[model samples]
Target: MIRLLLVVAALFGATGVMAQDFPNKSITVVVPVPPGGVVDLAGRLAAEALAGELKSSVVVDNKAGASANIGATYVAQAKPDGYTLLASYSLYHEVNPLLFNNLKWRPESFVPIGRVVVTPSVVVVHPSLPVHSLKEFVDYVKKNPGAVSFASQGTGSVAHLGSELLKQDTGIEMVHVPYKGSGPAMQDLVAGRVQFFITAPPAVMGYVQQGRLRALAIAGSERHPMLPEVPTSVEQGFPNFQLNPWVGLFAPADTPDAVVRKLAAALEKGLTQPKAIESAKAAGASVSFQSPQELAKTVAQGRAYWAALVKAANIKIE
Candidate 1:
């Protein structure tokens, strides 16, 4: 018993030493999407904020492609030291694993640090579509079947899952049209190439505000502060249908717990800065932070939720 206690104490002492000597150099933040997009913008904001808080430079690298698997797999396989972190969505860690049969990394390959934001997807339609509300959209889709088309940034993306959830809830049928990214999907939606899309508010805010697209409903339980006029899907009759394409930080699996805690603390401090708050506001996000454990729970719940959805809806990548 004495030897066992000694071993445990020695282990803790080593962990403490690791935490004390951590972050001796700059850290790299991997954004799994292309630059200039909403995810990239959020990552840059957090990186700048963390740099100040950690007293070390935090560099954001954009490695976008392959439904975000390229960057995700890169981070998952990186050294488990917390120096290389990923700023990505729930889809990459949760949904994609269920959608793709040959995902290189398992869902448990990364340790969730904490959530930075929860930006929900809004269900928007072309102005020409005869839908002024979620109910009307559902009714119209039912009547039109495959004639009504909805665009997504890519397969297995949150935008795709959001529409799939909508279809499961309302029993509506709409053809799926996948695009390279949200920009292209939004362009097609605006030009009438597709009638509806489940997209983040910032990606389509300009078109929605300019009257090119009509926002039928949001997937969040509460209306976004940026667009309070828009109602949530739950308010429109579907209950418990909340979907947020949130972006959060994660470290490679087996990363030192102390370093993960340190990053989480830095994230907490970063989210409180005035500059970070302004960035969140501009990005249509409510500045928020969570502890590493809280984030892990969120990830777990998200994985279970998406897995169930995929099973029930029979979603296939091909």
Candidate 2:
């Protein structure tokens, strides 16, 4: 019994040492998407905040391709130390599992560090839509039915899922036009190739301001600072239409609890800094730090939510 206790103590002691010496070296944050996108921006901001908080050189490595499997697999197989981390978002974590038949990694692949930033999706329409409000837009869509088309970043993305939710709630019919990325989607939206869109404030704000697009309401509960005049769907009488994409940090599975807590502390405090807040706000992302446990809860809720959504939407990758 004494020898057993000694062995347990030794194991915990080693874990303690590891947590204490935690980020002794430069940390690498792997962004699954290419540079210059919303996820990439959020990842870079998170890396900057961590560097300031932990006093370490944190670098962002972009490993883009294959629906984020490449970068996710890289971090999933990385050493279970605090140094290697993944900056991932909602679609990658929640929807990918429901969309893809074969994934390289599962939810157990990483331990939740915390949620970093949340980018709100807004419902915007082309200036030619003749809809000044969400109700008017809904009415028009109901009248036109399948004639009205809405654009999404891809199948099984937040836009797609959110749009599906909107369909279920409003009972409106619109053709889904999936794009490779938001850039092309936004361009086509501005050109009137598509009549409606629901995306983050960054890509749509400029167009709305320029009169190229008309924003009806934010999909979430709160209005974005960039587009303060636009109300939320909840306020506009669509309480069910809330879909905000968030980015989270994670380490490989089996990471020590102490280490995860320490990193979560840094992440929470770093997100509160004015620089971090300003930087995130500038990128149309808001810093809302979630503790490790809180993030895990959110992940679970998102999983069930997306699963039901996929089943209802009849979403298929192929």
Q: lDDT values of the candidates?
A: 0.84, 0.89
Q: Model 2 misses residue 279 by how many Å?
A: 0.4
Clashes of 2: 0
- In model 1, the clashing pairs are none
Instruction: Kindly report which residue stretches of model 2 are placed more than 4 angstroms away from their true locations once superposed.
Output: none
- In model 2, pairs of residues that clash are none
Best by lDDT: 2
Question: How close is each model in CA RMSD to the real structure?
Answer: 2.0, 1.2
For every model shown, the clashing-pair count is 0, 0
